[model samples]
Target chain A: MFELLGIPPQALFGQVLLGLINGSFYAVLSLGLAVIFGLLNIINFAHGALYMMGAFVSWMLLTYLGIPFWFALVISPLVVGALGMVIERTMLRPLHELDHLYSLLLTFGLTLVITGVFQNFYGVSGKPYPIPAALTGVMNLGFMFLPIYRGFIIVMAVIVCFATWFLIEKTRLGSYLRAATENPEMVSAFGINVPLLVTLTYGFGVALSAFAGVLAAPVYSVNPVMGNDLIIVVFAVIVIGGMGSIMGAIIGGFSLGLVEGLTKVFYPEASTTIIFIIMALVLLFKPSGIFGREV
Target chain B: MTHTIEKSQADTPGPETQAMLEVQGLNGWYGESHVLHDVNLTVNKGEVVTLLGRNGAGKTTTLKAIMGLLKSRSGSIRFNGTELIDLPARDIARLGIGYVPDDRGIFGSLSVLENLLLPPKVADGGFDLPAIYELFPNLEERLDSYGNKLSGGEQQMLSIARILRTGALFVLMDEPTEGLAPVIIHQIGHTVRRLKKAGFTILLVEQNFHFARELADRHYIVQEGKVVDQFRNDEIADNLEKIQGYLGI
Candidate 1:
């Protein structure tokens, strides 16, 4: 294998591949956030907590119930999504008439409660979730040994993102969601139940976060603190992508993940702060975000 | 078309009759500040009733209250003999009351066609897309354009068209011609005339007295959140002074 600029090709390509995988998660999570924010007008601060819950739920299913990873994968998101619906109906619905900040605060409080409860029960230690037996293999390319699971993750994320984009951009239900986001009263006047739609939209978005959480559970430890740090990164991604667009969320997430990964390769110390720095730059130059439209 | 004539003939009543839409002692508050107080009015089927007032005269608030957008304090709103005071905005809408806010409630991010498609078919009566296109020809041309990208007149037309897609029998339109060019205002006036001809009941709120006078068969002037005066179409000319005094026009 030839070395470029004294760096081995394998190492460079491997980091790039890893960056792309991380980007996949970012894209999926931020896409969910954008969808939720577009309709709910609420920055779901509890998104990370919900993500953690998704992972924990899967872990619980496997450990206590003796459920297989395959079943847990499908069932955990639904469980978390149901929980999201209940939260939306009970808590978020009451704050609909209030300021946008109130919804944000309420979601933040919810995140704290969820995270605290999970931590109190599970402790701060990370729990290992075994990779499904079928996915426990590596495919060696000419340059690098690629984990089959990571590749599966990237493909699944892409499919999910595209499916969501189609649902929102091309479908009638999506039309109603977009319309409701713009003028809820007007949509309600059309005999479409706007409140029910709001709750469902919130649940869908939370389910997306949970989906990402379940996908990450095998890669990362199922920890109570799993969502906290990832969410901060996602916020930066959203700021860069702009909340006004669904595609922007996807692109912003992946691009920033790749950028962060590259930063780790070239300058490891800057990796942590690079996303925030990019966010500040985007805000300074384009406050609406790279893809965001002005309200 | 035959039914329209029958409905009009049936609508003729003596001095007192049951109203199609009735608001009595209606009061509304935004937070703590009372915006509408003791507002009373009635709309008969096949009527073009205009609510005339100056800025901040609670004209728009009355429409919102009817649509259940505001918190009703002490009032009775009966739309087609159903109490609307405690109902949600969606329920009021399902009752065949279409509300067009003063802002022209267009979904800016959505295309004009998408905006039209946003409102679900109300009461299992299918929406006639061609009928709406016939009403607003400009909307037909700019079907792919985003609501925000439309001209003020186009946005207004789309707003009205959006509501019409719901097949609502009663429409409460707030300032459809506000800030529009004269040509667009003429178009809206024409649309209102067409709507009235089609046997649609309308409660229009407008600041332009001239426009209101042209479209309205009956008028209710509001001052300080109360109905101050009422006039028949024939009495409007005679009551211009009173209208000017109240509206400052």
Candidate 2:
């Protein structure tokens, strides 16, 4: 109904909501990347593939097995995480003592294999997952109309982000994660099984990506190459935020998403490139990242 | 699991009857280089023994080998009747060994309380928080502080305190007083004496003979990668010149 600087309130609100939605994906995906990088120092190039797997797995469950979105949400991640754990133990764990480049290559190859298989079976055209029956309507909040599912996404991202904070900062298991990340040998000497922790941490990190993937399934087209494009943006978020702190990743993701959204409103052509430009600026000035001091 | 460690302890001899630790013909390598050649030594229950050596003389490596910290190590490291050479550092720790390293490997990210809580309880009879704080009052005062925030002396104390909480009767300390004020060294010495009185076996590596002289019942002098000589605390009085001349200090 109102206009500011010749931009209608509807356009601004609509894009702002879109920005928040994209930010939620960034937050969830980058949280997993930051955690994996912090402890394992592995780049996990297959992160995007795993995310695609999460969405596709959920899609498979809904289509083939007649499972609902809620059940698929929990089941998809567990199945994907279990697969991730096996990959860690069999493939990544042996290369733990080697250089980071080895794991990077290993994961990159893994990404290609996953992408190729999915593309072979499904092709490039995408499948659209239907929004659940309960979350189909929109709520009119005076000047702005909010889609309930979209609002649900924003709330879910906030919840997931804060839950990670609790898991990493507050609990005793978190203490071990923090300690082991610093000097795993010392922690091992202190009588803790660090190898097992690494395996679990890898599984958990990928599980977050899968969870984000399931959240994304209903929003985005469930295609093989869907994660291929989004992962680059998610990684940019991690680079800008610095895989150092959980909160840093969350804020970085949300803020960058909003920036991209705003760019879409002001200049449609620059929306995609804006995040990369900021990422370059961040890397040039603060190479350690905004949350650089922490691990 | 804790069961692996507990089961080994149960098979050992009763307390005070035999040697708490018996390391024989131990050898260790760091990558391509051999560091420890023949580090044979023993520490009976409740006894205090010191590994005396100059820098780079393999004293620290001996301790590392015993604890299974080295990836390539050989020969026997028996702790309370369990052959420990095959076990990993963590398993050896679970078999009732506490290690305080030279660098005081404190996790900077964790708070003081978390550092203390990091090591799982290995056995019964470990000092409770009140008892540990009584021994090192500074730790209690700085419980909320980060591990990296502590002073050199406090970090050293924290390192020692955390291990003591593990109820590990066989204690291995590598230069606990390496860089500390005189007062702090005296306090550590007093703690060692008290630990001996409480029936904990100590295998300490020291270049500070004065500190070693006061606390050790026996001293094993390391040269290069072998135990070249040994002296009982009583017998060291007569061999002071030879010991000092050998030490070159």
lDDT by residue for model 1 over B1-249, one digit each (tens)? 122212443444432344789899999898888888899999987789999988888898889888888865568999889998888888888888777788888888888889888776565333377767767878899999888898888888888888777768689999999999998899899989877766678999999999999988899998888898999989978888877888886
TM-score of chain A of 2: 0.97
**Residue A114, model 2: Cα distance from true site in angstroms:** 0.4
Weakest 10 consecutive residues of candidate 1 chain A by summed lDDT = A183-192
Docking quality tier of candidate 1?
A: medium
Off by over 4 Å in 1: A95-106, B1-18, B124-127
DockQ of each: 0.62, 0.76
Candidate 2 per-residue lDDT over residues A1-295, each given as its tens digit: 6687799989998999999999999998899988888899999889999999999999999999999999998999999999999999999999988999999999999999999999999998988899988988999998899999999989988998899889998898989999999999899998899999999999998998999989988989999988888889988898889865677789999999999999999998999999999989988988777876733
For each candidate in turn, the TM-score is 0.92, 0.96
Checking candidate 1 for backbone clashes, the offending pairs are none
RMSD of 1: 3.1
| lDDT digits (tens) for residues B127-193 of candidate 2 | 7787788889999999999998999999999999999889898889999999899999999999998
